[model samples]
Target: MTPLSPDILDAVAHGAHHDPHSVLGVHESSDGWVIRARRPLAAEVVAVLDDGTAVPLTHLRGGIWEATVESFPGRYTVRATYDGTEHVTDDGYRHSPSIGELDLHLIAEGRHEELWRVLGAHVREIDGSQGVAFTVWAPNARAVRIKGDFNGWDGSGSAMRSMGGSGVWELFVPGIGVGTRYKFEILTRGGQWIEKADPMARAAEVPPATASVVTDTAYEWSDDAWIEERSRTAPVDRPMSIYELHLGSWKQGLSYRDAADQIIDYVGAQGFTHVEFLPLAEHPFGGSWGYQVSGYYAPTSRFGSPDDLRYLIDRLHQAGIGVIMDWVPGHFPKDAFALARFDGEALYEHPDPRRGEHKDWGTLIFDYGRNEVRNFLVANALYWFEEFHVDGLRVDAVASMLYLDYSRNDGEWAPNQFGGRENLEAIRFLQEVNATSYKRYPGIAMIAEESTSFPGVTAPTSAAGLGFGFKWNMGWMNDSLQYIGRDPMYRSHHEGELSFSFVYAFSENFVLPISHDEVVHGKGSLFGRMPGDHWQKLANMRAFLAYMWGHPGKQLLFMGQEFGQMSEWSESRDLDWWMLDQPAHRQLHGFVAELNRVYKDHAPLWSRDHDGAAFSRLGAPAWNPNVLAFARRDHHGNTVAVICNFSGVPLGDFPLDLPESGTWTEVLNSDAEAFGGSGQGNLGAVTTDARGSATLTLPPLGVLWLHHRADA
Candidate 1:
């Protein structure tokens, strides 16, 4: 058997070898050089060198064939014949190392910020033959093999070699092309074998199926102009009227390309500056709404390939709309073939279940303290921005990641090294990712969907903060929803809820989000939550939304809320598009579109969203109580003022402390007859007095936007 050890024969047969490259590839044995391969179906095997020197191979017991050649390792081919078919191919192992040593070092050290370029499945040319470089980090695995579609599902044939000292396993398989379905077949320490979909796969089979697809990421981007412009401007201190929609349910069953055109046109017509998709990453269950992701790197194949998603974002950019996606890094699904116990141990998660599992979410929490695990997550954030050209990531479930005791009771969670409930390692990881992302991707927004009192979330990292560009105002959403849900008779008792946001509005750059969470899971839709008959509920929605826009923060309202959906939001079906058939709903939609226009046109509303000086109460909530007013100002002067009344009765002369002494033009009135309101308002314009104040007629369940008309 050419002196091949029995141990080598046993490993080849059982697929338990950790260093198959040393045996199967062209190796320097005592007898010159020899090339070997496992070809179970082949009846005969031969090695052919570059000089046409054919060497016949001996058929060893375990479908292993090898031949000694006079030439050293160089360009070569292997010819294997099955029943009647002849398969000729270049030697997959006779090539230079696909991954460099420096890359392995950085990956081991967890500083490979662009690890996507070094790890994962990438197509590269080696020794004049194009193939794939497959790499994965699985330290606890006894052995790993590439289960390629071309491998005839052989677990014993394509065993990958573990790089020295490093946990990463790599193999350069010649003739492996793009679009090849592949996975890692891992041999556990206990000798059990299991197949896992690639965690870093850039493409995936449509779910209910768990195969990873090799992707060609050579997308020709057409958003150079948009990208260049975005590099100079950030969302802060700018008009940011965001339209948050669930991708799968937005207009059900549409490809990324088709949906992009339809959504972009609608968003543009509505004057929204950006569109936010609620978690586009691939997840096994559509019911999770992409929150419980399995394939973090792959865009769900339900909409098309990664390229198709790129086309969607590119098209949105060309149409002057920025795209943001919800990213869930707090926890991942415990799918057997996914990240859970990734390599037969808790490699990606904490070994202790108390620290590693999220009981409420039924998921595994990442071990942020682990170097490789942290790198995997941080790199994924950058990939979405750098590769897919996304404008921002609305990091989901930040509260779960920031605290150790999140969703856990006493004794169910462990404290930090400092004996606190804070997850210090996760905090450091967040800081590093935020700092690195800001350094690498200028003008890209890092938003936190945190719902706690965690201070300085949007503060600069240098200032001892989480270093996010913005933080969602979840408290405002909750308090205001509860306050607005009450009848007008009882609102006075809870007036503080209506005015409480200003207490800490500037603590962080805030994005006031009325997201899908508020309208789902028996919470009822935004329209349904209001207190009244049908018309009054619609009016309440319009009034509350206008108040949100006028508040000192960026705005993010979920889809269907704009058109006044009556039922709760459902991912199973499309938003209540048929609601627009009703005049009240159509008018509500128009009101929302105009609100976007008014928001974009006025600078004061957005110019100093983080500065307290840019805003001040006009009519205090305590006075007339049901009526509230506020003025939004820019550095130069006051640009607009908003007045609202939630009472059932109108005030004949409602007074507001305007900042500008000019004719205040009624820019928008939610109570206009066209908007299904009673059409009550000041005749077009009202002049303010010398003291910079105006007494205006405030309609019931109404909102008024006034602009300083200097020419009037």
Candidate 2:
């Protein structure tokens, strides 16, 4: 039997060998072929060949059993018999490593853009046998094994062989197919054993259950036409009115497929160009709103399978609505069975608590300095685009990723090599991801939700900028909301809040967002923010929305805002959809629709959005904080003037500079009663004298949209 080496048997018994294949599999010696197997608690072990030739093995110490065969038949099985139980399994050690050496080299260099394809449990056909090819990067692990339902959740049968010097462990288990629930059982360098969910798992057991599921992301996509058109079109020059939503509560009793139809119809009906979904990755806590991700590559099973999400994205594209997903690469949940202390060591996160932990969020920050970690996140970004065919990605909490001192006081954070508060590693990772994505996905948008004044947020990477297509204008949202919340009696005192945005409006490609962040956490709904009676509140909201549309940036509003839902957004339940039955709610909804329609129809409104010369302020900033006027002009000099009266009382003879002298039509009136307004408004059209100026009576708590009759 080639004299079963005692040293080799001891290494196998201890599970301390780097390559178990050398000792456990069938190997040729000078004399003949010898087979070795380990079945710890077995009474008898037999080598069973393909033709059912059972050769009994001589027992050695510590479960080592050996048998000598005349020749190697290549494929054979090991049958172990214990007390009244017989276990038949293929020789896992005989299989070749599923990962190639080149992949290992690229992984170590951190240049594997398609990293997920290599580092996760994949259902692959290896050696003509259909099964799963599993791989994981747990550098600090002493040993790694695959355990799943197929093996009674046991790891003793097979231990993954670590690729030399690469810290990656791989195994190809024959006969395990798709939908198999599995996890990596890793023995850490510290001698502690743990089971962790695969970080690159393409699908997971929908929360409540943390096992990673083997899935084939092989769904047919119908978004080819949309994708082709998207690649050829430029998004910055187009009108983008986004309706941000949380899929869980956007509607009631709806799966991903149902919500796809419902949401697309609603967004399209509202004349919005895009839908921005809150974080949709797999998360354990529903309240985190998918922000505290567990499976970075798996779409939250709360909706449906990965294919179900693709179906949703497909439907949205088919219905002419672009899908922008909110991606949270800033932090991840510290679930014990997940990434936390994976391999019983700080594998995925930084070693230091201050650098790794986000106290405010109770989550762990990513160790961006690690190349494999960087590869993980970058590949995840591309996975969403390539697999699900999402149109854009709104990177969440970018401000958190940018600053090392984010949400931390003195002595609580670490500085970069340059002694700056910037996270240099994260910055490089971000820049690389942005550059790579833009280079690969031509017209795909990469927007940032960065609230800080870090500079060049939306600049091209070639210009030493962050290379984002757009940034959420948090400053504008905060300023406008605070200004609108005050009584009209003291509004002019805060007039600068409204005008200050113009000074930096063109500084970056901005999406003026009144997102869910503005409405939750005791901040109150946008409708509930305005002062005074219901009528005044409605008027103020309409006027504010018109101003947002008139302003020089794209717009994004959360789901309930369009209908003026008074209740705050909740992740557990649906929005107060029944509120739409109220006349006020329906009118507000219709008003937003009209605003979107008008925004898209008027080239002047969107064509010159980022151009300073195309937008000019009328009157003075503080002349009447309760009243302000502005004119926006298109390339052809077609102009639309927006004037607002913020006070409760009406004003007469409000003179404003006009681009031309002619009959001016009042296209929209906030107090027009159709939007639950006071019905006070300027008549259909008014005459402007030859001085390029117009004088008109304004409605109480109203905003006006006027254009020359010739252009209207």
Candidate 3:
């Protein structure tokens, strides 16, 4: 055997080498060419050249075998006899590094916008060999190896080489292709070995199994026209009514493709312009509803493959419906198989316990101050838009990321450098992500679920603001639901709760969201919150829906609420879809469809949502009658007048001032009998007096929408 350094040989034997390829593949020695192979538990090792010449190699110390050949072979395979059986495969170490220097430079600088293209397990064809290339970032690890089903879950022979100073490890194994499962076995700096799923995996095994899958996409998108039209129109200018749903609980066993076909038709028929999904990122516990993400890049395998998700989005676009996904960049669960304790250090999370840990959620907060960590989240936001063709991202839990003392006691947290509770690093990270997302994908919406009085949340980043496209009107949701849950008699005394939202309605672009959060966690279904008997509860719901659509903002309704599902939402079970069989539930379902229809057909309700002059109160709140009247005006001088009556008694000869009218037609009446109401309203039209005022009978616990006819 040719002489080699003893330390180098020992490192190879112990799988502790920083650069294993230097000592394992074919090398030029003073005495001709030497071929080296590592095959543990093998009885014999042989080298097979491209010309079909097989040469036996002598076993050296510690699973190392070598032979001095007369000449160099352009290509070769390694053959090993294990348990009296011979297995031949292409030499994994013979290939060059799969990642380039430019990629390493960009990664080191934390400026790789397409980071997913270089980091995960990807199938590639390099140098006429078909195989899968695996790459990961583990700068604090002593060594790393690839372990998977191809190697019988053993990694002794698949040790990877570290790309110097880049914190990246890579290997291209030439026998495994797509669908192969794999994970990284890292020897931490403390000499402890841990297995971790790829942080950038495009697909993952269904939970209870934590292996990353090798994947590639060949989907031909059919949404060019949709993309072109979307880029030209601002989301605020278009009428947006979103139907938000959890895919797993919508129909328990449906795959992505199955849900797409059903959801496309339902959303289209109901007249919703868009559909929002709970986070589809891969996660371990189904109970989290995908909020605690394990794979930032992978579509959850609970539904289907990555390409299957692509097909779902493409089909929705073809049907003229936009797609928005919930994105959780706030924190992640402390699962041992995920990013927790990765590299035996707090690599992905903040080092300080006060800043890193979320005691309330039992999760770890991200270290937004870290450049590489910020890049991971920023590129992740772009990945959805660039790869999956999603039109928007509803950022989850903004308040938690913004405040340092959130859910913490006085002594449990630390203040920022400015002696404030604000998280400056997290603020900067959000601004960068929002600005980058909008700059790269024109007309894409970035919505924030912030519940605080934070200033300039929806303002432009150039003006030193957060740059979100819209902010959820959480105060509006809480106040409105609180007011409606009261008895009709007591509601009259608390009318401020219903009308106070308008005082600052146009302060920021807003979405009035009745999200899944309001329906879960022991909070009963929306129907159960209406404080009344069955009939009055349905009527109250109808009135609330009408008011929500007629208000000055976009609207998002959670699933199962349209049909008055009687039970609280549960991720463990499907929605109460069978409730539609009842007469009242069926009628409420039809009522929601009609409400969406009237909302879209009128420009006044949505076109000037952000202009304060677009909305005006008809008069002071009617304390005794429990009625509130308002009007919305569009830029083109069109008007929509809305009257909501919360009392159980119908009001006769109720005078309401009109914007301008000779005759006003009842465009939509929640009491029209078709919606299972008492069917009392202004017959079909009401004539105004010389003062532009009309006297009409408002139904009990109902709403009415009136529009002036041009000819009148």
- lDDT value, residue 703 of candidate 2: 84
Q: How does each model score on lDDT?
A: 0.87, 0.85, 0.91
Candidate with the greatest TM-score versus the true structure? 1
TM-score, structure 2 vs. true: 0.95
- Which predicted model would earn the best lDDT? 3
lDDT of 3 by residue, 59-174 (tens): 88788889888887668999999988999988878888999999998888878889999998989987778899899999999999988999888886788899989899999999
The CA lDDT at 435 in model 1 is 94
lDDT of 2 at 662: 84
Which regions of candidate 2 fall more than 4 Å away from where they truly are? Answer: 1-17, 40-56, 79-89, 620-623, 708-712
User: If candidate 2 were superposed on the true structure by all CA atoms, what would the RMSD be?
Assistant: 2.4
Candidates 1 and 3 compared: the better one by TM-score is 1
Better-scoring candidate (TM-score), 2 or 3 = 3
* Model 1, runs deviating above 4 Å: 620-622, 709-712
Report the lDDT of model 1 for residue 83: 89
Q: After superposition, how far is residue 48 of candidate 3 from its true place, in Å?
A: 2.8
Predicted candidate 2 versus true structure: per-residue lDDT over 490-581, tens digit per residue: 88688888889988998998999999888899888999998988877888889899888888888999989998888788878889999899
